[model samples]
Target: MTQQDIRKVRQEERVAELCAGVVRAFSGERDLHFRGRRLHRGRMPLPWFAPHLHPSPETDDFESFRGVADGLALRIAGSDATLHRTLQPEEPVERMLFEMLEQFRAEALVPEAMAGMRRNLRHRHEQWSLAFHHSGLTETARGLLLYAVAQICRARVSGEQVVEETEDMLEATRFALAPRIGHALGGLRRDRFDQAAYAVHALAIARTVATMLHEAGGDDEAPDARQNDTDDKRSVFSLVAEMDREIVEQHVSAQSGRSRLLEEAGAAYRVFTTEYDREHEAATLVRRELLAELRERLDRRIAAQGVNLARLARELRALLAVPERDGWDGGQEEGRIDGRRLARLVASPAERRLFRVEREEPLADCVVSFLIDCSGSMKEHAESVAMLVDVLARALEQAGVASEVLGFTTGAWNGGRAQRDWLRAGRPAHPGRLNERCHLVFKAAGTPWRRARAPMAALLRPELFREGIDGEAVDWACTRLRARSEERKLLLVISDGSPMDSATHLANDPHYLDHHLREVLARQEQQRDIAIAGIGVGLDLSPYYSHSHVLDLAASTGNAIFREVIGLMAGRHRH
Candidate 1:
């Protein structure tokens, strides 16, 4: 035998030793656990002491665990075969960790170059994983991220080496392939893969793992293939998992625990208000007494009894003084409100203080009725309807202008009956609480303007009066406002440009409510001081602009109707 044979035999022995190390590390056995490192498993990775330090599985050949472990293990196996001259281990885990590091060499794989790549890549991978695990990501997320880091070892699958993509890549790749694979298989059972059933596991490993990885930000950014692999131009999702994990550590969890709620990267922002109204309800022990006091004050404000104008004004002033928060800046957009250039806020001035007090009004005094169109035509614009109703309710509440909301819709198909009516008036505790109540208001008997006008007669023309310009919202507004108060009465009518069946509900149509609808419209041409506004939600409800008709009609696009509703209703000292 020659020196070549001796060297070949030595290399094989080294390979076996390296394989042994990987198997041990994965198994949670001795001489393998990295200091400060732990293997996480199950639904969410949580802390537990080292796997009870018990008897372990015997060391089968290095390839014995073949295909049983994921890519991390595969990379671990490949890296184990190239240590010593290839790389040096700083710890039990780093020895195995370098398997991936050596593979994605920054440059050519000349002997020295190959060796340096092993050291640098392993260091980067391990360091990254350590910091990531240190962050608050759940163990399940950590486990997936760690697994992806391990797979970095085999990023370049040279010459027919079996390599599974990182979990995120696998997930996205499987997505790209599963449909095609299914299409190709044409309904034959998804079974039989060279002697193993991997269809379910393969897809699970890719999609689910990738989602976990991407969510964790280990990343979804797909890397460019390292020379031998078939994949090119990595998907944004490839690094998405690692990216998620990294970003969480870098951007999110770095925040104090108070701010950590926003730490999750790429988190879906369903609700994003910085309010903690229910903080104490979640945990009994209180951390900040001020938070509790603030909460109590809020509850009082919501179900606020005996409207304290001075106290409320002071509260508003304090809130504005913070400068960190955002809210109504009567000082900023100073347009003429009620014939005066709007009163801008002036801190510490009696006039300003008095004015703020004046604006903080009584709920009963600031009454408004949002009469919305709920007829068939409203279905095409349900989104608009939702917006207007939401906006109106919120605006009224915000302005200290307590308002009741009522929707109407009379269906022609049902022998001229109201198909829906939703009406409710109560102090809403929060913005979302307002939204929930808005949903309930539309559950009653109601209809659109033309048809819904039929019910208005019941509220307006009760006694010797028969017909003519009698409707609920307008009549209610005028009659309610008649009480000698300085507060203006508001009637918000949201409808399409059309009027319904009421104009002809007369004797020739005696079967109807013995009142002429057209006569009623003519009578509306002579009202006063009833603050009227018409909001057309995604429709042309633009027949307003006079004392008789609503004087204001704003075309609110998208969900702006609600914001506009608040803007329209926010008290401007209407007399």
Candidate 2:
């Protein structure tokens, strides 16, 4: 790691330590620990206060970060989690508003004597407001409405002035919402200390906002009755369009009902054809110079993250190491009395039967395979994934464990040659896995990580991503892992979503691949030949894998990401 990177890592460590002490002192929650930018009470993350816990250069200063720390501490101390949970609205839009309002309520409860803390809170909120507004989130109607509600709620509850910068921009929204939520706003201030009482008013405002949003037709339209020029405009219009499409798609699927292809096929999976299946070395697919460049870039990024590889290696060594009874030791200082050493004991009377009949040694006899989902959506997270996997591989190697980096994707979009061949065969019923399987070997188990570094960069090659056939990929990775001579084998599958072969889904059923993937996982898990775990890139893989860890790639920093991965390897995830 470079000097600057080292400094950053040290600073983050100090911040975490300080914040942890603050959380403990203020909340009296002794078990809360900060990890992956989120504070966790045991394994469950306290994500409600995530925004305040982030350690950034700007927030690293005394006043700025203390405000963040104080706000978070107050949130934990003031908010009643059980009450919040019980009172939370069911609707997504309403629920978001309810949560935001609750956070403001907590921040508003700052002690009167702590003038510094009060200023800190006001300053931080203003900073956040400015940042949110400048980010163009306010350009969209929904974003602006949410921003306005947050500003008004914070100001009302804390008895502080609203951010001046956004006051003009939110004037119309504030006016529109005032008549509807005036009484609720008063109740929120009156009942700020009483969570159950405050929730009534909070929910009232939340429901009002949600109702307005629904009545507005879509989030694209203004929540307020008035149509301002700014309300209709959005900087990233495509994102709103995409969200609309997803909503429509979900509605259509709900109406259409689920596919019964599994029952029809009688639990037997049938592939259209395996003629198009291809397995290739990932390094060979890309140009040498480009691969090297990607590797260099990855190295710099990983180094900047300043992951303590040595410490990680030690932890992995402790976790993965297996105890083995080597053999009996003769003439030991103290151990089980060995009958064979009685003669020696007689020769040296003080020795007594000191020979040890058993000796245990920790052996790092394990192989870990990382199976990556190279689906199209994963392209956005490719760089982060590559960095995480590469660092892990290096750490595993340092710990004397074998590691393999592999990926799976279809050779062509929407089932390429396999679909054409299936069509030629008159589109037979229940044709499972219509896509051409393309398994990639980025780094083999036998190869050292240093030598295989270039190929591992293939994870960043966008074109290599096409489609994901998760079930087959898992089976393939398990097979390779099981083939290893190690005493223990582990297969870690990383993916954002489920098995999605469009052609197979369309030709047979939407759930054909999903069922197959589940079946594969169940069978492998039952046999226990190898331990199968999952790391969801930005999703929950619990539906598929029994043991899974969800990594929020967007919210987490590199060190945080690595720590989470290590926790997964140590089997810290929920069973």
- lDDT digits (tens) for residues 397-499 of candidate 2: 9988999999999999998999999889998877788989999999999999989988999888999999988888888998888788998898888887778
Q: Which stretches of candidate 1 lie over 4 Å from their true place?
A: 1-365, 411-486, 502-525, 538-560, 566-575
Return the number of clashes found in candidate 1: 53
TM-score of 2: 0.54
Off by over 4 Å in 2: 1-258, 265-267, 327-333, 336-359
Candidate 2 Cα RMSD (Å)? 10.1
Q: Looking at model 1, which ten-residue stretch has the lowest summed lDDT?
A: 431-440
Each model's C-alpha lDDT? 0.31, 0.76
Clashes of each: 53, 0
Query: What TM-score, over all chains together, does every model reach?
Result: 0.24, 0.54
Give the candidate number with the greatest lDDT. Answer: 2
Output the number of the TM-score-best candidate: 2
